[model samples]
Target: MPGPVFLEGEKVTLRPPEEEDVDLIQCWMNDPSVWRRALDVNPTSRQQCAEFIEDVLQGDDGVHCLACDDSAPLGLVSLNDSQYGPDETSRARDTELAYWFDPDHHGQGYGSDAARRMIQYAFEDRNFRRITARPGSFNDASVGLLESLGFTHEGTLREAAWFRGEYHDMLYYGLLREEWNSQ
Candidate 1:
């Protein structure tokens, strides 16, 4: 919506999701590994995913963009205005960055590339003051990606998220515009 038409990386392109991308979204979201790492076991129905695409196009709280490459659909990346709740992000001029990559493309730097592009757009194009991200404490790859992009590890909420059967921590990361500019 308010973001760019397309963001380019070396091996991927992040573009606004289209109606045709619904099926591809379903496929990636339904992947067991994706569910485990990203969605935390919440199953997605086709109808719900259709609604999601509509929401994305309409800028439903700033969710946008699907990542793809010449190979196939890779995953989804978003710059959401809201982080934990409607109240929090509503007060701050900040956005939350979230992403997931297909298991097949893991460790190929697609996630980092997409995130860096999103950060650049948020700071330069959108004029955002800061961006925040929260990743599951056990998710090392996500933590590494955020850290590599110069996001500060703000804190960890202990046992804040319950996934599968047990409770897991959530690590909060943030990058300020001043910090990004300094880099």
Candidate 2:
């Protein structure tokens, strides 16, 4: 319930997203290489970024954190306590984990590190029973990160999303508290 706070790790730190991050996220959102793999690739303006940070900061359903070091903005991480399904009958008390690193920082394991911290927060701090992640099938880096963090591939929804002017499959991954603990 408390506003999101900075989370530190050996490689990086996760902090409450700030206004300065808007321009950085905007740059990433606008990059063809970055957004092409994202579920939403449309150009996002400063206002949208502000609204997004506000939503993450104020919304009860989630926590969003910025990944940074002593240098500059590296990426973003988020954990949402909500159901993927829209209807109550199909909903579960689940947390959704999402993350992204600046393309320049992609191969350095920042995304995986951030994701692991969020997963820890969900299972340990938040007492979540389970966490789920969905990455585009073509997004191999994300798939690898989730797998390394003990997320099992649930299944792929065939052509479940339309992005970057094409229909893409959505690969679902999940980790239960027991599973996370065992790992």
Candidate 3:
């Protein structure tokens, strides 16, 4: 079963991943349709999935949540501490947002509703200054979702991602606290 609700939206609820959710997460991780657009395309083992939940998802470095409705979890959303590049100074107040939904649940507006709620928590409760998102150029759904949430298309790294035996560009998006408040 999923943990108690952590965040709620109109069409979905966000909660922490529980031990029982390992199998489902593993299945999603290994699904080509799901991993193709994510940064890691490698096959994921059940053990790895378990470790991911116990370590990364539950770790203090970020806020990770499972997006669910009244019935079952539809996806995962997170706000991780941004990793600064060599030329950039580390901004502790900034976070990198990411999410992925089950292909079966796509086009239902659940992803958008969950993401919007996460962004609201980031700015209103966590007091994060800015949130960034990086989606592969090939993932039109992800790009559209980010844009719909009012994230600006800040830049793109050409052919920075390799998947499905080819390279694809990675698009960057950003949303500031003030910008979100204005919307």
Candidate 1 lDDT over residue span 1-183, tens digit each: 323448787777778877777787887778887877774576788888888778764465775776777535677888887544444335566889999878998998888888888888888887778899999987889999999999999999999877667789999999999999888
Worst 10-residue lDDT window for candidate 2 reads 84-93
TM-scores of the candidates in the order shown: 0.86, 0.87, 0.93
Candidates ranked, most accurate by lDDT first: 3, 1, 2
Tens digit of lDDT per residue, candidate 3, span 58-158? 88778899999895999999988777521124565788999988999999999999999999999998878889999999899999999998999999999
Q: What TM-score does candidate 2 get on C-alpha atoms?
A: 0.87
- lDDT of each residue in 1-183, candidate 2, tens digit only: 112447777687888766656777778877777777776756788898778767764465588787876546688788865665423233465878987778899989788877888788878887777899999988888998888888999999999988766788999998999999997
What stretches of model 2 exceed 4 Å from their correct place? 1-5, 84-91, 163-165
- Give the better candidate number (1 or 3) by lDDT: 3
Candidate 1's TM-score reads 0.86
lDDT of each: 0.79, 0.78, 0.89
Query: Which stretches in model 1 have alpha-carbon errors above 4 Å?
Result: 1-5, 83-91
TM-score quality measure for candidate 3:
0.93
Q: How accurate is candidate 1 locally (lDDT)?
A: 0.79
Query: In terms of lDDT, which candidate is strongest?
Result: 3
Backbone clash numbers for all candidates listed: 0, 0, 0
Pairs of residues clashing in candidate 1: none
**lDDT-best of 2 and 3:** 3
